[model samples]
Target chain A: MGLGKTDKQILAVILAAALALLAFQYFSGHRSQELVLEISRPGAERLRMPVSSLPQGEQGRWHVEGAAGGVYLSYWPDQGVHVDRATCPDQACVKMGFINKAGQSIVCVPNEIIIRLIALEDPAGQGEEELDGVLK
Target chain B: MTAIKGFRGVTKTYMKKAAFVFLCVALSGGLISCGGAERAKVPSFSSTRFLMDTVVTIRLQVIPGNQAGRLGAVAGGGQPAAVPAQEELEQLVLAAFNRMEEIAAKTNRHDPGQGSDLQRLAAQAGDGSWLEVSRDTLFIQEEVERLEQEAAAVLPAAAGLVDTSLGKLIDLWMGVRETKVLPRQEEIEAALALSGMEYIERDWAGGKMRLTLAGMGLDYGAVAKGYAVEEAGRILAQAGPAVYGIIDAGGNIKTIGQKPDGSPWQIGLTDPLKTKELLASIELAPGQVAATSGDYQRYEDIEGRRYHHILSPGEGWPVWYSHSVTAISSGGLKADYYSTLLFLLPAQDALELAESIPDLEAIWVTASGELFATSGIEDYIKWQDKSGYKLRD
Candidate 1:
């Protein structure tokens, strides 16, 4: 039993559409999403906002503020994240510059704010795990 | 006709088996994709708990892709063994910290009459008589005795500068944590007079140690934690050869192995003046132990003056030399002892003294805020903050 001419055309269309979907994903989607800035403050869950969602280099943005008052975090796609503004006395976290590496993190003990860079394979922000550590 | 149908049946069975195999391969691919590219490989794991009177953190690195499904000896193969490598490391690290706690219980001074060996020894030291010790206690006492000889040779203006003999001075200074009062100058002087390694006698053959001075006590403030950290590393190594772990008791950090990727571990050096800022990051190779002692942690602020815990042996007062000192040794005991010495030694003598010692790498940061490293550590340190003090090559 052989396929009819119409059946062959339908199968050809499905194969072409599947290949097109793969190409579209290859070029315009997925890979670029891996760079993310994760903000965590004491007594709250970690908020992993996309680097794109963060207003780039914009100081004093409410979007970056946290639970215990406000701790402003900033990040650029290539540069990484840092505490732009904080209420703490020393401002050591502000002085830490940026930690753009995959496992690097900027911690502010006074305000209990920690911003980490999670550079992973999935741009869609799935399967992200926090590095194991005790903050003293 | 019967033979032809039998052949057809065999052909159909083969086709079904082939389809099932293809489906299984597709499912495996899906599982790999679902796990994420990075997760499919062994990821670094960390855990933090309060141990040894401070926050103790442990980090274990990369379980290579090949070792992903395998569990370490501690976990065993009695259950669903698909536990990720990171999970395996976390469990093993917990075991290591438990070992540290057990050792701490045997030796810690703060827990006096808690049945710790230190408390028992302190009671025995009342009459300056020899007392037998457990194997763990003996190991720590031996290290303490060895450090006393090392410090006496190189450290300046010192007697209780780096030994358990300072137990008296430490007690006077630490006072009752609740009352939080500084001891009178005369009281400190009295404690200092009784402090010196010459007062202690050790008989390794008899497995006993004694304090010759009736009022003097022995403490391993600088040495015991390193021994504990190293012991923990030993336990992890026995469980898994590839386990790369670090036991960081405050500033004392010892690595069990190099990272799986074969790169050195990056350890941040805290700025002596700035309580929270990191002044630099140092890299350590496999089996290296690093420690940083600073004036920041334990200090008394009186009348707008800061008196750090590191006291000079000769002056009977806190030593005013460097704000902090960093030391890395091939082993934990040496690093802990030398780090304390670098902090107490005069700034002018520290750099040269650190260089004279073999198998020891040290960096001293003066109170005036200049960072100086011996030639051994010059290459390993990467300075982060350069405003107050420049990293002099």
Candidate 2:
């Protein structure tokens, strides 16, 4: 009634592989991913940067200059905001970024610049691809 | 062979039954006792009523017996004996009342600034040049003389009005007359200095001019409960690191330390109409103050028309809005004053003021059953019934 040796070996290997996968998922993988955005639009050109790459203390700000004008964008100490200053015809984008919602953008129509905030969890970015089999 | 097999099967069944019974007993006991953690002595907080005044009491969990001695030893002070406790508590309350009085005196406009009546008169009589004095100067001079006489008269009368120091504060508010001129001037100067009102001297008389308080009609009722709480805590804290302590002056309450089992204390805001009913319960940890002011506490029934005690500064009348306002802060005195002030101000303005302060929280229950509270309040405290009060951001 005992199982054959090869069959037992195969089952043991499968169990070991499952445990390894679980360990990998638990220890190193990120439980969450946060996106902090700073965007400044000057005339037609839009300047955007992720907070992760900037120096630790300077992550909440961005400076941009163009032929049309110069502007600065800074994050609010509370929640999210991107304040900008410019001499553009519309000056619309400067008033935007009070939020950084997924797929939302600060648009300066006259300047042809768009500062977008795309959530890292956005399904569209995956485009039907699997991300580490945890989420697709 | 058949008998042997039958005997083995019977034994197996009996063993299984015995195991099941043992398992059931173990599981039932575990469910009841919840495992070796001594049934958390539902550490209690009690309320005592004295002369229409209620004191909420919280008996905290600590290494019991002679805790005062241990605390005394740790703090390098002699153990405060049992007989002296009441006297000491009363003295602390009186001291705090004195400090409030000092603050009030500086804020009072009618007290001639440190000058004798004769000196003030001499300054006014200057070379008999009445025409040289400006109108504003003349008015101020007259105000000083009037205040001097009133101060002499009312100071003695104020001594007999209320039973407790708290009552004294209330009587001052009800009877005293004159804007908080001295305190206001000092506050303005402090505000300009950017040092904030807290850092300014507890007593700062503005312009050194003693303006008499109007008919001695100033009250510190709203602020006194907090003052009492702070005083009580000072005495208690001197004893040792108390896990939890609360002093509820009537409905106004202040809490410190964690609960007996080391959780936060849960405080219920009473429904103004149904005093027994709870509008909301808030969980607070150690070292915080919470004070409530309501229309129902001191309402007047004039021709069957009911009116509450909270009054507006400008019109000297009460403006109805929230049935009650409860403010939480680290300091009891500030929380006490602000709770009454918030009731007098608009909801939006009150919220703005609350936000300006760090570590401050509030719950406003309006006439419409709407509840307005700040964001930090939500995270720090848990609400029992989300139904009665609507949460305004």
Q: Give DockQ per model, in order.
A: 0.04, 0.01
> Which regions in candidate 2 have their CA more than 4 angstroms from the true location?
A1-136, B1-52, B56-214, B301-305, B381-389
A72-104: candidate 2 lDDT, tens digit per residue? 445543345454565586677776646556566
Q: In candidate 2, how many Å is residue B358 off?
A: 1.6
User: In model 1, where do residues sit more than 4 Å from their true spots?
Assistant: A1-136, B1-38, B41-46, B66-91, B126-128, B150-160, B176-182
What is the C-alpha lDDT profile of model 1 across A85-125, one tens digit per residue?
77778788889988876668888787566778764333122
Model 1, range B28-131, lDDT digits (tens) per residue? 42333423443233445544444455545555655554443343332455332233364566567778878888888887777645867666666676485778
What lDDT does the true structure give each of the candidates? 0.63, 0.44
